[model samples]
Each structure stands twice: as C-alpha cells, then as structure tokens.
Target chain A: MNKIEVCFSPELIHLHELQGKIVVVVDIFRATTTMVAALANGIEEISTFADLEECRRMKSQGFLIGGERNGQTVSGFDLGNSPVAFIKNEYSGQKLAMTTTNGTLAISKSANADEILIGAFPNLSATIAYIQKHRKDVLIHCAGWKGRFNLEDSLYAGALVKSLESSHEADEDGALAMKSLFEKEGHQLKGYLGQASHAKRLQNHGIEADIDFCLTLDLYDIVGKVENEKVKAVIKP
Target chain B: MNKIEVCFSPELIHLHELQGKIVVVVDIFRATTTMVAALANGIEEISTFADLEECRRMKSQGFLIGGERNGQTVSGFDLGNSPVAFIKNEYSGQKLAMTTTNGTLAISKSANADEILIGAFPNLSATIAYIQKHRKDVLIHCAGWKGRFNLEDSLYAGALVKSLESSHEADEDGALAMKSLFEKEGHQLKGYLGQASHAKRLQNHGIEADIDFCLTLDLYDIVGKVENEKVKAVIKP
Candidate 1:
C-alpha cells in the first residue's frame, strides 16, 4: 500500500526525505486557502516563489502579485494572504505570483516531489480524490508560522489522513497522530481554531472573518497541481 | 498566568527560544520513562550526555551506564532503553550516566533552559504539580525520533497542557493541539500507539512490553529534575 506522511513544518523539511513522493502544500490559516479560492474563482495559475525579488520580477511581467509578511500584505502587492480577497478579485485567465510567511516557501521547497498540489479545507475532498487516483506515496507539507508548527496546517493534514487511512498506510506516527487530532476536533472546526496561534494572530488583526471562511469545508471541488513551477487547476476531465 | 508551550520536535528547538523557560524533556518511548522509573525505584540521580564517549568515561568511574542506538543497548553499557531493565537492576544511592538515540540528545540540547525536568506518563501528575508549584512558563521539549516529531512524546506533552489549562495560557497551538491529542487518546493509549512509528519499531524488536509499561499513568509519584547537570529525584523536599 502507498503511505501517508507529514512534514509538520517547513523547518522540519530536512527531517523528511521526500524524494519521488506526491506532496501537498498546506497553509490553512490562509496561503493554501487562497490558492484553492483563486483556482475555484477561475484564476489561470499561481507561481510560488520563496524570494520576494522573484515574485516582484513576475509582477513586472503582468502577474497579479500576492505577497505577505508577518500576517500583513506586502507594501504594494495586489493581494495579501487572504482567500476572500482572491474570491472577490476579478481575475480570470491570469497568473498569480505568490510569496508569504510559510505557504509559498513550503511549495518552493517541494521541488523534489514527483507531484505537488495545493491543499486546504475548501478543496480537501478534491485533493484526496486526486491523491487516490495517483496512488503514490504522499507527504503533507505544512507551512507553519515562521517555521514553527502551527495548528491549522496539522489539523488539515489530520483530516486528509483520516480520509485516506483505509487505502494508505500511515508511514509514521505523524500520520496517525494527525488523523487522531482531526477526528477529535474535526466537528468543531471554527470553535477549535479560535484557540489556534495563527488564527489568534489573524484575529488580533481583525481577520476572524477569514478564519471562518477558510475553515469552510469542501467549498470548491477542485485540486491545484504544481506543474512547471506553477499551480494550475487540475479539474478532472 | 504562566504559559504552556510545546516544541513538537527537537528540530524546532531554535523556534522555542527556550531561555528562562522551565523545560520538561520528554522521550516517552523510553528515556524520560526510564528516568522517572529510576527515580521511582530509588536510583539517586542520572547524568545525560549526547556523546557516547562521556557516558563511557562515566562508566569507568563506576556509574551504571545506559546507552542505546536504533533501539538496542550500546556495547559495554550496563542497561538498554527498557524501563523494566532499569527497574530490575538495583541502583540505589548511585548515579547513572546515559546516552541514547533521542532522549540524552534532547537533554543536552536544553542546556540553556532556566530549569529542566524529565517528563513521561509514569511521572505525569507529579511533573504537572512540580511545574504548577514552580509557576513558570513551560516548554515541553519532545525528544522526537532523531530531530523528527514522534507521537508518544507529543501526546504526553499534550496531557500536561490539558491538565494545566486553567492555570496557564497555551502559548502556541502545538500546546493546545497536543493537549487535544492526549485527551482523545489518553484512555486508548495501547491501541493508539500501536500505529506509532517508534512503537512499531519497538514491536518489531519484540519490546511491546516496554510500550505498555511506559504508557502506564502516574505509575510513579516522582519528578526528576535536571540540576547540576544531572537528573535527580525531586521527592517533595
């Protein structure tokens, strides 16, 4: 059987040997939520860059630039780490170049993976179906709060593990532990995330609405796949 | 109010900024379990070393040395990782020098902490009471499987956070998430840990007995303090 693993944080990326694995980049507090929202909202694709300068260069070439640092939008980007911002934007058939505290960095680091996909609550069922179709070893790469493990990302990883457990082996304790957490707290998503660090950080900035929106399950029935360094909607034919 | 935090793995040690924090080192499969069991069975003290050479030298000086690598006792050490092994060997009024794959390394890494105590399920309640009495910010540093996150340590850390919730604010979601995991799995430990990586590794080596004993709740009414570079019994004095 194929296996499921989790790199709990980007800082722990070195701890996982992800070669040839199918990877899902998750930044549930916003980045991944935005990616899924953009895809569902009909954005053409998203290019992830770890370097702000690279994202800036892409911006000059007509990419709608989205960047964030320490929970706020970059000084001049068209979008910050907000999914609702993506949903509201009039961006059809356009490229999104993204950089953020954790999400983009996690996506960028997964270059070695055989396949990479954007994941969040909104597109969760789609992501699972996609992985099951591929039937490859999977790694859920969580973009944590500034390289530290965050609750939202791990919780979503847990949800994925729970959905896939019948067909896939939990490669490590992380997979099992994460599934247990999601099972225990899956029902009270909004209430549970009220205690999350990143959620609280956003709440302090008065983006509690974003939390409620991002935690909305299966809002979009699509999976965003990374190909040629860009995340594009893998809408099944 | 003091804060409760968890370093889900030692790899995130830098993210912890452990200075001035009361740290409880946890390597639940064996090391911290052995430390508490040693104290419970009346071993005077233990000195943890990252270097096998240091432990070897201490052995020459008549310390009952314990060492492990890949779940087996190191050559020439007095004991391996099993809590039962320690309980069987009488070492009253003597010091133990220890080195292991994860636990001792975690202890050595926490040298900058304001105070360090060993934690495991066997000594859980006492460990909690000790921290409450001390009334300091706490970081539960999990000695994961070689700088990677492991299940048992994080679950025990969660148990600590859940028990201490009223008195201390959870500093991060790792703390809250950990507590939730503990609450969910605390009763079904054996069944839950049957899927854990380290537990399966041990079972492959036919040491499920160790896992069963290690998960036993508050089996010992003791707390082991790391003072003067050694872990000694803190018997309410």
Candidate 2:
C-alpha cells in the first residue's frame, strides 16, 4: 500500500521524514499555482529563493526577478505573487527568479526529498497522474501561511487525496480529517477559499483575481518538479 | 473580542504566545478526558508530568499513579490512560500522578499560560462556557501524536470553536478550517473517530470504551484548569 501522510504546516516539516519520500508541496493561495501557470504559459526556468537578497542577486544576473511579501509585489521586482501575472505566453523561454512568503520556503525546506513536485488546484491532475505512476511513500507538505495552518493549503491537500484513484484509505486522523473536509467543501471551493484569511489578505490588497485564478482546477497539463533549486515541467511517464 | 487560535500540535506551540492567553489543552483520546473524569468523579488533584521520572517520584511518595505510552498502560502504574478508571467514589480525596505520551507533554509546554484549562469531549460545554465569561485571547493547544497533527484533536478543536457562544470570530484560516471540520464531523463523531489511527491503536489494545468515553459530550459539569501545576475543577460564574 502506498501510505499517505499530510503535513499540514511547514513549521513542523521536520516531524516528517522527507529523505526517501515523494513530497508534493502545495501552497494554494499563490506560489505553487503561479509556478504551474508560468510553466504552462511557457516560462523556461523558475528558480525559487527563500531569501529576498539571493533572489534579487539572481535578478542582477539577468533572471526576471519576482518576489512578494504579504501579497504585495516586492519593491524592485518584475511581479507580485499572483497567477494572473504568470498567465501570459509572452514570458516563454525566460529564466525567472522567484520568491514568496511561504511557498519557496517550503520548497527550500523539502530539499532532502527524493522527488519534489509542486501541487496546486490548477495543475493538480497532472501532478497526481505523474506521481501515481511511481509507487512511493507520499507526503503532502502544505506551505501554510507563515508557520501556521491555513485553510487553502489544507483544502488542496484534501482535494489531492480525494483525487487519487487508489483504494483511498487515509493513513491517519490528520489525513482522514483532511480527506473529509475536501469531500464536503470541494464543491463550492471558491466560496470556501474566498473566506480564507490569506484569501482575505489578498482581497484586502484588491487581488481577488489571484484567488480566483489559483482555484481554477486542472488549468495546466504540466507536472512541476524541483531540480537544481528551480521548478520546471516534467513529462508524465 | 475573544480572538481564538487553534494550535494543532506542540511543534507549532512556539508560534503561539501563551504568556497572557487562556490556553485550553486538548487530548481527547485519553489524557484530558481522564483529567476531567478524575476531577468530576471527585479526585482532589491530578498533577500531570511530561517526564516519567518526575511522575514516578510522586508514585513512590504514596500518590496514586497512572501512565500510558502508545495507548497502553505504563508498567507498574496503578491505572492505564482510561477516564473510566477514575469514575469511582473511593478516589474522592486522593491526589493523582499522571504521565502520558502526549497530553501531559502539552500541559508541560503550556506552563507559561495565564490560565490552562483541560479540554476534552467530556468537558467540552463547561470549558467553552467558562472561557467565554473571561474575554481573554484563547488558544486551543492540541496534543498531537509525537509532534505531528492528528485528526481527533483537530476534530475537538473544531467542536470547541462551534460550541462557543461568544460573538467573536476566528483569527485565522487555521481556526476557520478547524471549525469547519468539527461542525461537519461533530454529528457522526463515533464513526469518524473509529476510523482514526489513534483509535485503532486503542482498539488493538482492546480499549473501545475509552474511545466512547472520550467522545461523550459534556459529561462533566465542572471545568478542569491548571493552577499551582495541579489540575482541579473551577466553577463557571
């Protein structure tokens, strides 16, 4: 049996053993969704940085710099953390330097995993189909807002588990509870996601479109995996 | 407003400042349930211990001892981690020494709180009613298994949120998410809890009654709170 464990927040990522597991990092409010949209719309390389200085330094070397804090665009950067900003075909073949409040930090922390995939509602099916091909111990690592548990990330986790075509028994109470939430609220996800604190934060900044774009299901047929610290598309076997 | 934040595990305990907050400790599988039961059935005091040696020292000094590890009773202790064991008239004036895997550890971690109330399904209504009277910032500290998020605790966290009669709202997505899970699963809790991994652990040890007793809503009229490091009943005004 391919057992699944859902790590609800990155703050306690150390409690999970990621070394040999297939880790799928989900940051549904923005980062992972934007990464998928960028790749599908044709950005060649998206290098994730946990530190703004390092991400800015890469920008000086010719990468399109994109970073944000608390939903607003980072000063002196090309983009704010929004999937809407990434949904353009003009950015194809560009190497991008990316950083965000939570998602990139989650990616940096899961550096020990054997295979790391970026998961969000937009690219969920592709991500799930790719991982299902390989029978490995799976852990859904949620990049919760600033080291605390958040709804959108957990909702994404539950949706992923429910999306699986496996026998579908959750490994523990956390997994079981998440699976239940997704099943009940998965129908009106927009109504639910829109109520999230992070969603409200983005909405407060006048960016409800970002939340809407992030919640769009299966927008891209791309499965994103981490390689050399940059997230890029990989073909399904 | 009584702002509520539900801290899902001890790993995220540091993210919550307990200094002036009213922290409600939840470990529904046994510890908090047993504490409420012991106090409700009339034991004078139940001193919790995170360290086995500390709990054992009290046992050696003529206090009645009860301990559990991985859902089984600890060796040489008078009782296992069952709330039913405490529902007796004979233990009315005796003090108790308790050390468990998760619940006691949660109490030890929240030693800095202004007030620490023992929360479980047994004391659910009383705990909620007592906290609403004192408009302090509330944190529902869940004793997750081995520093990871667990379903039963999150379910209890949700139940507490839904039971609150206050006009206050949840502070973050975590609180909202927990509240959603509790309201949805609060009805078929026995079926839901029976599906949990921790419940299975107890069942494997032939302790189904513990699960039933833990799931009982508001079994006790008194709220168990920590003062002077000892758990005792407090009346609601």
Candidate 3:
C-alpha cells in the first residue's frame, strides 16, 4: 500500500522527504480553492509566485495578476484570493499570475516533490482519484496561516486520507489525527471550518461567502497539477 | 481570558513566541512521564540534557543518569526512559540527569519561555490546576518523535485545552484542533493513543506497561517545574 502523510504547515515542510512523494498542496481558505475555480472555469493555466512583484511583473506580459497579503487583495492586482471571483468565467482563457501569503509560498517550497497537486475541498474527489491512479507516496502539504497550523487545509487533508484509506496507509500521527478530525467534523464542513482561526480572520474581513464557498466539496471535478510552476486543470478520466 | 496554544513539535518552536508564556513540555510516551513519576516518587530534582554524553558524565557527580535514543535505553545509562523504573522510588532523594531523543530537546528549546513545566497524563488534573492558578498564557509544547508531530503528546495538549476551556481561549488552530481531538477521544485515551506511532515504537520493544502507565490519568498530583535547569516537583495546594 502507498503511504499518506501530512505536513501541517509549510514551515514544517523541511522535515518531510519530498523527493519521491506526490505533494498535494492545500490552502483551503482561498489559494488552492481559487486555483481550482480558475482552471475549472476555463482559465488556461495558473502560475503562482511567492513575491507580489514577480506576480505583478507578469501583468505586462498579458497575464491576469492576482495577489493577496493578510487576506486582502494587493492594491494594484486584478484579483484577490477568492474562488467566487473565478467562478463566473469572466477571465476565461486567460493565464493567471497569482501570489498569496501562504499558498504560493508552499507551492514554491514543494519544488522537490516528484509531483505537485493543488488540493482544495472543491477538487477533493478529483485529487483523490489522481492520487489513487498514481499510487505514489502522498504528502498533503497544508499552507497554514503564516507558518502556523490551520484547520481548513488539515481538514482537506483528512478528507483525502479518508477517501484514500482503502489503498493508502496513513504514515504518521499527523495523518491519523487529521483523518479522525475529518471523520468527526466532515459532515458539517461549513459550520466546523467556520470556527477555524483563518475563517475568523477572513470573516473579520467580511468574506463569509468565500469561506462558505471554499468549504463546498466536489464542486469541481478537475484536479489542478503544478507543472513547471503553473497550475493546470486535469480532468478526470 | 488567558490564551492556550499548542506547539505541535520542537521543530516548530521557532514559529511560536514563547516569552511570557508558561510552556507545558510534554512527552506522553515516556520522558516527561518519567520526570513526573521520578519527582513524585521522591527524586530530589531532575536536570535534562539533550546530549547523552552530558547525561552520562553526570554519573561521576553522583547523579542518577537516564537516557534513551530511538525508543531504547542508551548503553551504560543508569536507567532507560521509563516511568515505572522511577515509580518504586529506587533512586529516591537523588538528583537525576537525563537525556532522551525528543523530550529533553523540547525542554531545552523552550528555555526562552517565562516558565517551563513538565506535563504528562499522570498529572493532567494537577497540570490543569496549576495552569488555572497561574492563569498565564499557556503553550503546550509537545515533545514529538524526533521533532516530528506525534499523537500522544498532542492528545495530552488537547486534554489540557479542554479542561481549561472555561477560563482559557484557544489561541490558534493548533490548540483548537487539539481541543476537539481530546473532546472526541479523551474518554478512550488508552485505545486512542495505543494507535500512536510512538506507542507502537514502544510496544515493539515490549514496554506495553509503560504505554499504559503513560496514558493513565491522575497517577500523581504533581506538576514538575523547571527552575535553574532542574525539574523539581511542585505539589498541588
């Protein structure tokens, strides 16, 4: 059986051996959710940058720039880190250059992984399907809030672990804890995740809709794969 | 309300601000449990060293030396990391110099905190009462398996958060997650923690008794406080 593990925060990423693992990078509050939404709605590809200046630089090359810092949109960026913003297909066929406080940094830090997949509740099923197909050791890398553990991403990891339990064995206590967390609270995703610190942070910014939307499961039947630093949609077979 | 937070592992200690906080350093499988047991059973004071050599050298000074590496006793140490070994008061009235793979390292790293307390399930209520009496911001620093996240320590953290819930607010997602975990599995702690990676590690070495002893609640009514680099038992008022 393939092994599944969880790295609760990007700060703890160094402790994980990523060389031959398929890392499912999750930022459930918005970043990975937004990527899935953007790709599912016809955005050609999503390129993530850890630096706002680097993401903004792509605007001159016709890429739609999206950046957020501390849960707010960068002053001059075309979009904030919101999945709802990408749902209308308004930027269909465009390439997105995005940066966020946690998600993009996690993606960049996971460069050594054998394969990187963007994971969120919206794309959870597809992400599991992809992992099941590949049968590689999996690491769910949660882009926690500013290098601290967060609830939403870990819940997403738990959901994935539960789904993949038949074929994959949870490799450590982190995975077991998350799997148990999801089992207990998975049914009330919105209500449970709404209590998360990151949820409260976003709620304080008056984005309850984004939090609700981000917790919606299986909305997109596509997997987001990081290829050459760009996230592209992988439709289910 | 006072704040309660959990640092899931020593490796992630750098991300947490330890100053002015009371850190409850826990190694549920053995180290802290051993300390609590040793102090409760009449050991004079316990000094922790991260280096086995330093611990070994203390023997020449008439201190009882206990050391472990990777779940086994280090060669030539006076005792392995076992609470049972200390329970008989075999080394009563003697100072203990100890080193272990994770617990000692966690205590050493948490020296920046205002107050350092050794925590274990055996003293769960006492630890809670001590925290309530102090009413300071608390950080439950789990001495996870070699700087990685582990179940037993986090569960102990969760138990503290839950018991202190009325007076303390969870400071972040880590604390909140642990609180929920404890609430969900607190009653069945032995069965729940028996599945932990570290528990399995110890069980493989034929120390199932230690695992049971470590998970037992309220085995002693003492809080081990670190002062001048020594853990001296603080009896409950």
Candidate 4:
C-alpha cells in the first residue's frame, strides 16, 4: 500500500521531494467546488493559468474566460468562483479558462508533481477511485487562503484521508491532524465546516446556500486532471 | 481594537506584508518551551542561530550550546531541546546558544517584523501582557516542525488567540482558524494537543510528560524577545 500524506498548504511541499507522488489539488472554499460543478453540469475541459494575463491570452484560443477575485466574478470573465455560476446549461461542451484565488495558486505550485487530481467533496468518490488505481503516493494539496492554512481545505482533506485510510499513512503533521479532526467531526461535516473562515465569510456575504451545496459529498463522479495547462475529464482506460 | 492573527506555520506568514506587526514566535516542541523554562529558571540570556557554525562559535564564547535534531541532543552540545534541561537549577545565570527544528527558523523569518516576542504556555500571561502594551498589530508565528505544520504549534497559537480575543479582530483565515480552534480547546490544551503528529511522536518516544509540561499555562511570567540575535527577558513596560 502506498502511503499518502496530506499537506495543509502548498508552501509545505518541496517540489523536488514530490517528484513521484500523485498530487490532489483541493480548494474546497470554491475553486474545486466550482470546477466539479462546472464539469458535472456539462462544461468541457478547463484550462488554468497562474496569472490572469496568461488566462486572458488563452480566451482567444477558443476558451471561455472564468474565475474570481475575493469570491466575486472578475469583471470581464465568463464566470466567477461560484458553483451557481457554473451550473447554467449554456456552458456545456465549452472549454473554460479558470483562475481562482487559492486553487489556481496551488495548481501552479504543483506543476511539477507526477500527476494532479482535483479533489472536492462533490467528486470525492471518483477521486478516491483514481488514486487507488494509480497506486501512487498521494499528496493532498490544500489550497489555503493565500499562503496560510484554511479550514475548509483541511476538512476536505480529512474526508479524503478518512476514505483512503486503508491505503495511506499520515506522514506529515497536517495529515495526522486531518485524520484526528475527521474522527472528531466526520459525521457532521457541515457543522464542523461552519467554523471555517471562508464558510463564514461566504455566509456573511449572503451565500449560505453555496456552503450547503459545497458540503454535499460524492455529488458527482467527475474526475478532473491537469494536462498541458488544462484540466480535462480523465476517461479511465 | 487591533486585529490579532496567529499562524502556526512560518510558511503561513507573508513576511513582506507583516513588516510593522508585533509578532510572537511559538515553538512549543522545544525552542520556545526551552526559552521560557530557561528564563524562568534563571538563564541570563538565550541566543538563537539558524546556522550550526554560528552556534558552535557562540558555544566557544562560553555560551551553553542547547539544541537538538530528530528529537535527540546534538552531539557535543551542552544541552538539548528539552524544557526540563533548561529548568535545571544548575544552569541558573548561564548564557546559552540554542538552535532547534522550528523556533529559530521562525525568529529568523520575523527579521522584518517591528518586534518579536517568544510565546509558550509557560510564559503565556507575560506574552499577553507584552501584546497588550504593544498593540499595534500582533502576529503569532508557530514554529512548525521543519517548515511543516505541527498541531502543538497551532494549539499554542490558539491558546494565545484565546487570551487576546476581546481586543483583536481575527483578520485572516489562518488567524480565524486558530481562534476557532482555541475557543474549542484552549482549556484542555494537553488533551487537544494529544492528537497532533508531534505529540504522538513524542508520546511514542516516551516524552508525553514533556508535552503536558509544555502545555501548562503561566508557569513563568517572563516574556522572551529576540534582540541582537539573543532571546532576552523583557518587562512589559
């Protein structure tokens, strides 16, 4: 069994030390939530960019510009960080150029990982299945707010760890902490997650429904993987 | 009221942005714990260094070399990273050069902060008193285990946030999370910290008693501050 470890923040990872591990990118606050919802509702592949200029450059190449800043849609972008914005049927089969506060930052940081998978409560099962088949050491990359630790990301990581407990070891403190936190509140994710800073922020901003929606587990089986600058739905061989 | 933020991992700090804040360095695993214990037991001063060579040079200057690596005392060092070792009455009035896994790293990282104070449970009240007097803005730096997040550090941060909740705004996600965690377990720090990876490791290594000792609040009233490369006792004036 391969030992999977969870890193609570991207800064915890030394890229060179992770040469062979399969990395899971998690931004539960909204990025991965937005991604899963976009794909589950029929959007095509999503291309990511570390910088807004790069994402803008790709929009002319048949990509729909989408992303957010401080939880709102960028003025000219096609979509924002809201999962609600991603659910309209108009986006079916169109490529998305997505940028987010914490999610894209983490993706950019994990550019050198052997493989990257998007893990969110919405797509938990598919993510687990993919990891089990790959049989590679996994690193759960929590896209913390800016360079700091965020609770939503860590809770999602805890959920993943709880699901994959048989196949992974808690190598780092983040991993162990997640496991313990999970044991303490796994049965009531939404209640525990209510304490999350982003969740409270979103709620205070009058987006309480989004938090409820984001906490829905295994709502979609869509598996998104980063390949050549875009995250595509992986068709399992 | 000023906003107080606590970051358990140095990686969580955006040092460039924290230029004018009053920062507290907490490394309960050994560094801050030893600092508080030493000062309380009468060590005259404690100097910290990131480089072993600098520490070695100081040791030759009649300073006691006190530090550890991988949980063991460094070979040839006069003392290791144990709070017990620092509390020994035999070491009263001595000068010490210390280096450890996380605490010194945090101090070095705070090179740009307006001022830095060491926060450990033993000196929690004194640290809070220093914060009250210097209330420009406070950032607690949790010296995590070698650039990785450790539960004990975060819990210690929570203890600090719980102490100053009435006078500060929890600004960022990391700070808010620390505050939430503190509110949840500040009273049972040892029990709360028992779930951390470092605590488990220390427990497995038969040092659980040290973990308990380190979590005890207000054992000493000394505030440790790093000035001129040495951690010296400071009064709240």
For chain B alone, what TM-score does every candidate structure achieve against the true structure?
0.94, 0.94, 0.96, 0.92
lDDT string for model 4 (A124-168, tens) is 898999888888888899888766678888878877887888887
lDDT of 2 by residue, B1-237 (tens): 677889999878888889888999998888899989988988888888888778888976778898877666788888877899977665777889998768877888898899999998887888888888887888899998888888788888888777772644786776788888877888989998888888888899889888999998877789999999899889631
The residue-by-residue lDDT of candidate 1 on B167-190, one tens digit each, is: 888868889888889899988888
- Where does model 4 sit among the CAPRI classes? acceptable
Write the residue-wise lDDT of candidate 3 on A112-222 in tens digits.
999999998887887888899998999999999888889998889899999999989985899999998888888898888878888988999999989888988888889
Q: What order do you get sorting by TM-score, best first? A: 3, 2, 1, 4
lDDT of each: 0.85, 0.84, 0.89, 0.77
Q: Write the per-residue lDDT of candidate 2 for residues A13-38, one digit (tens) a residue.
A: 89889977889999988889988888
Q: Which stretches of candidate 2 lie over 4 Å from their true place?
A: A165-168, B70-72
Q: Where in model 4 is the C-alpha error above 4 Å?
A: A69-77, A132-135, A182-212, A235-237, B69-76, B129-136, B182-209, B235-237
Best of the candidates, TM-score? 3
- List ranges where model 3 is wrong by over 4 Å: B70-72
Best by lDDT: 3
For each candidate, report its DockQ versus the true two-chain complex: 0.79, 0.75, 0.70, 0.40
lDDT of 4 by residue, B113-171 (tens): 88988888888888888788777788888888777777788777767777788777775
TM-score of each: 0.95, 0.95, 0.97, 0.85
In Å, residue A41's CA in model 3 sits off its true spot by 0.5
- lDDT per residue as tens, model 1, A1-237: 899999888888877878889999999988889888988888888887777877878878999998877677888888886889867648877889987658878988888999989889988998889888888999999998888888899999999999998778886888888898999999998999888877778888988878998999988888988899788899931
